[model samples]
Target: MRRQAVSPSCQQLGRPRSGAASRRGVLSSAAAVLLLAAGQRPSFATLIPDAPVVGDCPECIGEVNETLNACPLDAPSCISTLSDDEEHFAAPWQFDGTREEAIEQLISIATGARFDMGLIDSFGGVRQTDAAAYIAKGVLAVVSGGDMPEQPKRQRKSSTEFVPFDGDVTERRTTPGGAEYVRIVLGTGGGGATQASNLSEVIDCEFLFLPDDNIVDVRASSRVQPEGKLGSGGQLALSITEGLVLDKNVAGRQVERLRKALRWDVAPVLTDFNPAFNAEAPVWFERLFDPFNRRNKFQPSGLAYPAEGEGEERPLRLPARE
Candidate 1:
């Protein structure tokens, strides 16, 4: 769950900050104030020198200090005063495979049957596969959750529905830095007439294949404003990273399905947890104040496949392979 910060000037260019971003800004100021009152050195103050300080603040500074010191810096929304770039989330990985193997892995995860089955039990199941068909044509459309009218009434719903969107995928090319990469431009709509006009949700995903480094950098950025929590784009990037290089001892039905799909000789090791996927507070905070840390956490909105005994499995309509 690594984030890239942009300059304040860049953040202010035409795009108004979201309420969540504003709230985070206020909380950052409060944290800075607590740091000043406690006579403790602020680590991130240099990044945000303009943060406000309160005069003669409460004695709760000690409590705040204790919590801040105990928590990990990368915890979701944990001490992140820096404004994230429109490219909200990055999930880079080093794997024991060749560039060709890495490309195959990406394709398998995006279009394979086993991977599709794995997603059925998970949150936000695939409602359609036409968008995925583009991957074979050198374009990948990473579908995220978006709202759509639930038919008959033609009223908009919340951002919890799985609506398919299509985006153009650029051909593989070499970067100026000598790294090979593919750029995927994704957005809601462009798939069908019924798809809502969610141009604001457009995002670009870049898959950078570093030369001789065995590293694949998966970066997702929104074209509109920077993302606060784990949106659909962030989740898709994280899921792709997990599929390619899962760490050892990370147990989940998804992981099991991935193993069966790829049929790797050795299971990949789990090195670090993606903050957007699984954020944890200190043990004390979890035991005493769990709900506070759980705020803004990412939860899967819908399932990928229908449940058992519901009905016969319906075939997904995908573009025929040439």
Candidate 2:
């Protein structure tokens, strides 16, 4: 007698599910098996067109893999190296006043010099303890500056404006030797999205005030940007230090005493070092792909200073210099 072949759905029906559901599941499984046999697979590149593929640059992939294997699991968080745009100044800048008075004096002198140099548009002391509050205030200041109307030709110095002390402005600490240390962080950056001419920059300044020794030590450093050739971090640091020491009129008796006591020239010494030299890619990866992607570059959606006859309102033109 000839025996009838058992269908997959018929076999599954006796094992578990209802006849209709089992038939559907069996059909789906068969379709998947046929697809696999035909060498058809899902393409991730189709789903994410912009995603980088390792196979695209086999050499880079190999190098990356080698680097990963070479990097130790227990490596130091930060590797210390010399800075290229760091300036250090130490002198007998004795202050015959309390710590609070010294801090106030420093702030006043710094703020005045920055304003005179047109480095900052607006600045204030950081009172709130949290990092969030400090960052929020800085962000708000940038937003406000962006909304501000263009100043008169004579009043406006440069196109760029900065808001400083975007992080912890002042921090006080005591050493095991009972010596007091005060770290004053002075960060300055561009006026945000509105200011197209301005580029973001960060200046990390730490001031160590030692009352017993009657000397104040200062270290100012900034990252050297490839695009920012005109603004030297060394020059910026020197400018501020010079203003503090040489501004006899504003600094009053404290600076006067310090100057008189100092036998040698009080100048900041510049040191150059780059810790990220080998850690990062040789060239910025963004710039490599920038030609293919216009979005990588900044495009002003709205103009802070629109051109004359281009908008509904007449643009304010700067008067020609005599």
Candidate 3:
């Protein structure tokens, strides 16, 4: 005789109340699963399209795998061979210009010369400091009378003056490979100027160029003292380390990162080594060079009159103010 088959729920009827509840729970779970299968897809898969794979380029995958297998030991060799070359001061220039052009440009920077603004526009509205240097050199050539002018001097008070201490071409040489390098040290310090002066400024700077390496390094230090009326009466010091080079790809990446962090697309990075300032300028002080309000003043006696004149005009007094 065949025994009648009993439902699982029917078998649980003889168990405790929890057994009946457990049977209902199982039935509820099965129903829920069926409902889920019938409805829309889960949230994770919704955003991603129904592609077979994400970014599934075989070549890229192979490259990633190869890089990973190299481990930390061989990592240094993985970088491109032509990457940035940091060498001693005697290293040859790595730039893409002729030796004569490089020398002219280096000399221009040693003197306080300004370049054409068009050079900045060439690099897509960015601060191409390297290009600016070359352009400045060209301007210096045009303005110069075949020789650099005398270093500037400023009078601190009666019988006292501050002149550039080491205003000379420190290094001018050609490498064994025929590449030219120029370095100029321009600075003023150790002043015996008058102690009664209200304000005095001292500046020391160095400029170096490696044409073959396409690198420029600038090191500068400046100090401004205000004894009275200039401000609350303190010393304002500034130091800068600026190294620039011609680089587009890495510069573009730098610009992109800056754009994201700043939430605005600013100027492109035209030079690799950006200028660095150790301390921010106080808000009260204006920029050292104001392009808009540049003034040129000179004594007219040197322009026209003789070196010596009559007793009344000896001092060469200009017309009285209106």
Model 3 Cα displacement at 48 (Å)? 70
- Candidate 2, overall lDDT? 0.31
TM-score, structure 2 vs. true: 0.26
Model 3, position 51, has a per-residue lDDT of 12
State each model's CA lDDT, in order: 0.35, 0.31, 0.29
Clashing pairs in 3: 93-212, 93-213, 94-212, 94-213, 94-214, 95-212, 95-213, 95-214
Answer with 2 or 3, whichever has the higher lDDT. 2
lDDT of 1 by residue, 1-322 (tens): 2223355685576687799998998898899899889975455311111111212221101112111011122222111101121112222455566878866675445332233222432224433343344233332222333343222222232335433224445346665566776644444333322222232234334456667777664443333332333331123222321232222111112222333444333323322223333232122234344544432232221112222354333332332212
Q: Report the number of clashing residue pairs per model.
A: 8, 5, 8
lDDT of 2 by residue, 1-322 (tens): 2223345696656687788988998898888788778875322111101111222131111112111011111211101111111111122235555655665556544433233323222332222343345566667768887443332222323535432223234445554544454433222222221111111223223445554554454333221121322331112112221121211111122222223322213433322111133111112354354444332231121112222253333232332212
lDDT of 2 at 183: 36
Candidate 1 segments exceeding 4 Å error: 1-89, 94-97, 104-115, 122-165, 188-196, 226-322
Q: Give the residue spans of candidate 2 off by over 4 A.
A: 1-92, 107-170, 189-201, 223-228, 231-322
> Candidate 3 lDDT, tens digit per residue, 1-322?
2123345786666676677888997897787788679873222111111111112231111112111111111111111111121110111123346546655654553343333222122354334564566567766976874554343232122223212122335445554544443433233212222221211222222223433445433222122212322232322333222123222122122212222322222222221111221121111122334323211111221122223234122233433212
- TM-score per candidate, chains pooled: 0.31, 0.26, 0.21
* Cα lDDT for residue 60, candidate 1: 9
Ranking by lDDT: 1, 2, 3
